[model samples]
Target: SILSIGWAQWILSDLPQDSLSLAMTHPEMDWPTAHAACPVLALAGDETLAGCVPARRRRQLRRARQAASRCGRIALLSASGSPQTFLDQLIRLHNMRWAEQGGGVLANAAVEQFHRLSLPLLDAHGLVRCWLFAIDGGTVGAYYGFHHRGRAYAYLGGFDPAYAEESPGAILIGHAIAEAIREDAREFDFLRGQEAYKYGWGAVDRWTMRRVWTRS
Candidate 1:
């Protein structure tokens, strides 16, 4: 199964005890569990990114900025145009990075279609926050997220590996966090991952549980 392929955990913590009744109603169906770990950055009142991150990370961000600056100018563009215009570039950059990393959800047709349709609606409601990073007039990275109820969720992001030494992705994320702080967002959620990099950004672990119900 795809879940197995992805090494997902099968949790039965919330499954109903009366399995016999469930079997009578629906038979031969197998259930799978969904797993996720959300890494969150709690923002203090009017805190800046420099204030939120550790001193070491602050230094790293500073150095990254310096390295990237030599290429010309590093610009962070967000919600500056129609969602339609941004989606194509966003997906293209995302796919480019994912392709280099083996593969990702963006490679899936359904997921691609979902973003293509959902971004417009999210943008219309001002819930969507999309950002692109450009160096010397060349697009290098993109981030798509949602801001709602005083929280900013970092949904997805991608950067060209060709600029890996410059760390454009990290630079873009730092700017996004700074923007969220300026907007007075209470939390910046790096949704659905326990990746090591999230911790470097001063994120704390918030685990999400899942349950699978099976008929016997």
Candidate 2:
């Protein structure tokens, strides 16, 4: 059965189930499948941000910091008091970066609407956290994600291409991980990506699977 296959491959790979039965039936339909590699940084027992990465990455982060500092004042702002005010800026900064690269999730109307409507609710529940990296009073980078069940997930982010050479994106990520550690999160999850930068933070690969069901 499709359900059994999904359970075996994703939910619980070690579980044994020889015979499975399906009580419902439906017509077959085409379904799409998606795949992603999630990178995760495990935090345990008073580990400092610098301690979580390798020596080479630490040097890179140091260089990024110096470069960002030279551009102007670099600040990491979070969505704590007035989240609404930051949401607009976050979207704008994200679009600025992705727009030049062609497009991104925010380019879709439905996805943008979902984020607008959900941000407040998630904020109220303390599940969502957003960060903006500003330079000399201008927003240049943004990080939006959720913290749940002791895990801090890096859901989405963007940085001004103008600062690409300055490495604002990498700097922001470094700050995010530091903040997560301060908040006592057990793990920092780079939700879905095989991006090389994620590995610099000492993140490990975790496979994700998608399940599709069609009745025959």
Candidate 3:
């Protein structure tokens, strides 16, 4: 007999009663493991997008935007034709900050190549989105994410550390969240991680479980 295993599978909805009963009745054949939490921001509220987050975060974002503006005009640019250019920018900007720290998620050639090959297909499906943050006409940050099935997933981001005081990443996220609202997404998912910044945006955790099946 062979066994199948799944890890950290996102549980977006309740399981059928029959499925639960099966798992309980045949622990050896099927069972659940520890759960992982993902931070998600509800976008279905009646409040405006600006009001979706906490007051403190709003104030902080204001200050950061003002600070960054002082350097130059800030712009959030979206990829229209070929998203590859924006993806490259993301990799460069991300590496500028994470390289010294032993490289970021996009640092490896394999990872970069994977995105290069997959983005076009995803973009064709209208699921891929990339936003570049620029100050004084120079790009300082980039956000890579996806919108699907009424949810916007904040997948990855990279920023110029030189603009640390300006909070380019945070500012870009604010704009991205607004875009998500315009798209009528029901939730803005942070995907995975317990990063403190996610909570600042009033994100709540949703749990997912690992399910395993084995032949007896």
**Better by TM-score, candidate 2 or 1:** 1
Give lDDT for model 1.
0.76
Clashing pairs in 3: none
Candidate maximizing TM-score: 3
Query: Better model by lDDT, 1 or 3?
Result: 3
Q: Which segments of candidate 2 are over 4 A away from where they belong?
A: 1-35, 45-48, 210-216
Per-candidate clash tally? 0, 0, 0
Ordered by lDDT, highest first, the candidates read: 3, 1, 2
RMSD of candidates 1 onward, in order: 7.3, 6.6, 4.5
- Those runs of model 3 whose alpha carbons end farther than 4 Å from true positions after fitting are 1-27, 44-48, 214-216
Model 1 C-alpha lDDT per residue in residues 118-153, reported as the tens digit of each score: 888888888988888899988888888888988999
User: For candidate 3, what is the lDDT?
Assistant: 0.81
lDDT for every model?
0.76, 0.73, 0.81
